[model samples]
Target: MRGPARASYRPVTQRLEVTFLPGLGEIVADEIVERLAPARPPRPVPGREDALLVDHAGRLERALSLRTAVAVFLVLTFDVPRPKSLTSGEHLPRIADAMATSVRLGAARTFRFEAAGHDSSVFQRLAAELAHATGLVHDDAEGEVVVRFRRTPRNAPQPGATRAPTDQAGWDVLVRLGGRPLSARPWRVADFPGAVNATIAAAIVRLVGTQADDRVANLMCGSGTLLIERLLAGPAATAVGVDIDPDAVRATQENLVAAGCAGRATVTRADVTAAGGSWRDAGPFDLVLADPPWGALHGSHVTNPALHADLLRVAHEVGAPGAHLVVLTHEIKVMERCIREADAHWRVRAELRVFAKGHHPRIYVLEHV
Candidate 1:
């Protein structure tokens, strides 16, 4: 009768490792260090691609919530005297013991195996062998325990804990902390055709930076990912989003509502090129973020060039002096030409390459002069 005794949860702190998309590891690393201060300085795993291992000291789930990386894992390392011995059946029991121990550490009931591309066949065989040795069913469908195998780099760091037997093998077993990637935001209830990846959006907002009272604008704001991410990054005086398509505008509205920023953010349907309007009266935002359509993906190829030029000009006019603008696009050549030829008074501040959904887009940060 007392509201079911009020549900509660106690946080668990543990040391862990994180892996992100190759090009974006540094940003993920910075975010992690800023959010959760690790025991020792976080280090990029030697010879490992896009991995940062740290001895963290806070609740694992809390630390996971603070990061935007693709995956967080409880790491276990094994030694193989001979790399070729992996294919032999001799090490099966030891590998199974390591996996079973990792599952217990992750507190998962059922488990699955995931390996990238060609290594999948090797992992499948290893998974079967481990299942036979440990009596754990290999359930790929709804496995709560996710056992991922990785070929450890030659110089990978030693494990922080001695629970798992460590010899001198070149393999690492990582049990994923969450079922899904942290970048998949829950606020994305309504998605537009080419919505920006939420992790990339968070990175862009971090690069642009913010204050408690800065006014922000997002042009071509499809599904409002950028705006929602910016809002989450920090408080703002006002946030506005504009798009030419009514469908996009509606989608932004829905996403904003889902993100609980409906009151703090506004979305309108209007051509961004036509600058002198009521939108301009709101005038001179402290930051402007744009993710214009790349010609090859959703919109037609012809319109993007003109749209890019117009976006620069309009952003220049609507941005306050010393304001910042961040733009993401795959049409780098065209955008570069626009920056060269346009009358807009702006200078490129920084540029970063980020991979998203099979397309490599460059994010340009510009400062209003």
Candidate 2:
């Protein structure tokens, strides 16, 4: 006689509530729904108003309730990249004014202004002006302040790079501004790297919502910046990142190890265009997130319109039905056509314009409808 057979520990899906930050609303919701749909088993709908009842794996549950859930919960902070034409004196006031307007327009609740590529005195002056305009008490040591407004509740302000000191935890995403300077590139063009702009990145992440146990994958993973940030923003299903560039793969691997997420995340070199190639050998994934190369930036060498189409086709083939495909692209016509031609049903969930230098980059939230 033997003891009872050891129980196999299968993962179970749980009900989750998702709130997209201010600008991300329906686009993020649609993306989240699409990503989770294939993994969900068909189940009878539950009676609910303003709530999306979804079948998670084998479990029936409500994932998001517009009425009950706080729709926009996350706030983003960004440091302005120094402009090529501006001197220290001119730059500080311009950034300070921008920050004030950003807060006034409700883009952020609070912000930490930092001086990059210049002396600390510039940042101090900007901070002082921000303090005066917003009626925020300044903390010189931490380089932050609190904004006072009628709508802001007593416990609203939280201390951090992005939020007021009183803001609650569990922010779906957070972004730090300032771009990495590329080697062999001039300072002006090197300001913005492939990593999405900080504010825009946070907005997109909030749009995607958060899942405690959702399996997520990033194809064409660049520096693994998004993956690293996602790991830090916890309660994910699981994460896997792949890049065609071996150097990017190596960097991602090193970053994961350094961030203590090597156990939960993996990075590998895999060409997305290869036929029948699959990341499933890694594990079943729930979400496919990517910032595919923009044709405009890479020109004809790396990413072109044809390559975009091929990538979308491959993404559809590898992705589970109803999985959300969130992508950032500057070429609108190219992406629109690619999605139209792909096998998976795709709908534009959200769109945003990211200004870099003089160009405006478009971020698209595509859903596998």
Candidate 3:
């Protein structure tokens, strides 16, 4: 009986405490949690109060303290569904205090706060209050704070501080569309090129796992957005974009050239529904990405259902087995139906609900099985 086969256990070493602001979607909050605790299981009970234990790589406990520990507080504020004011300042400080207490208990010495919302004044006040409470001087030079909240039990002086990424870079560059300069504003309700579009584009690049040299296509490539992003990412193997709008095709070409990727990418004027004949010329592509118009949004008078059906038919015909197909649209039911009708042994690897400009844009990633 070899001593029960010597059970092996990995140490539960890294721990992080996170607080979610009211009105932020649970899904987005959960993603933030996952980034911190990649291996921790989901909370077992609903509405239970406990510090979240996240396992980031490395020895994190020694790094904990008021002046020296590395920790961040993320606050997201939005309108509370309906019957609530479109904006409010009532809960901003309360949320900030809640997060501060969490980090204090965790023995984190240094603190950085990030507030995302429509109101800038509320966040500024909250930051001032947090700095005052901790006795940490706000270091405008580095855009963070260093303060000794309390001496540890061992009388060990807390370590010095380092800045959080958000404090430095502001926010992650989630997506780039059609060579537009980066923006920090939220997406609008009536149009595209909002946060939702940026997020979906970033997700596609992340989930599809494309190399710098993989040949990619944007079938029905309106404005050549998807193709432009791919080129910005790297010198892809090759990129071919197609669209029925000659204006859109021309714009795509111009954007690619301006981005210095015209040589690696090309745009042609062709309707995707009739893509079979033309797309064959650009065969053996590694990926196909598109954001077909959700009905009249792309300036077409066609109904959403009809457009969805046509896009799916074209995708099935053009996509090779195992090729990645990434689509972003607002027509949830119609897109689902299109995937079903394809019947080409495809599997949906991921789906995301993006809030842009006021409409919920859903993104679907289908891989041919």
lDDT of 3 by residue, 19-124 (tens): 2222223332354443444555433111222212234443433223111111332222233432122123553344344445444444243444322341356444
Better of 1 and 3 by TM-score: 1
Q: Write down the lDDT that model 1 would get.
A: 0.76
Best candidate, TM-score-wise? Answer: 1
Candidate 2: lDDT over CA atoms? 0.51
Q: Clash number for model 1?
A: 4
All models: lDDT?
A: 0.76, 0.51, 0.51
Q: Indicate which candidate wins on lDDT.
A: 1
- Tens-digit lDDT track for model 2 on 1-369? 999999998755533323323343444445445555636532211221222323344322222222212321112222323322223454434444534543443333445533342236644554566566555545533422222111112243333446544532221111121111111111112122365443344445666666787778888877666665566556676788888877677777776676677788877778777864556565445567777777544435345678778766666666666667778777777877777777346777777765454556677777665
Which sequence of candidate numbers ranks them by TM-score, best first?
1, 3, 2
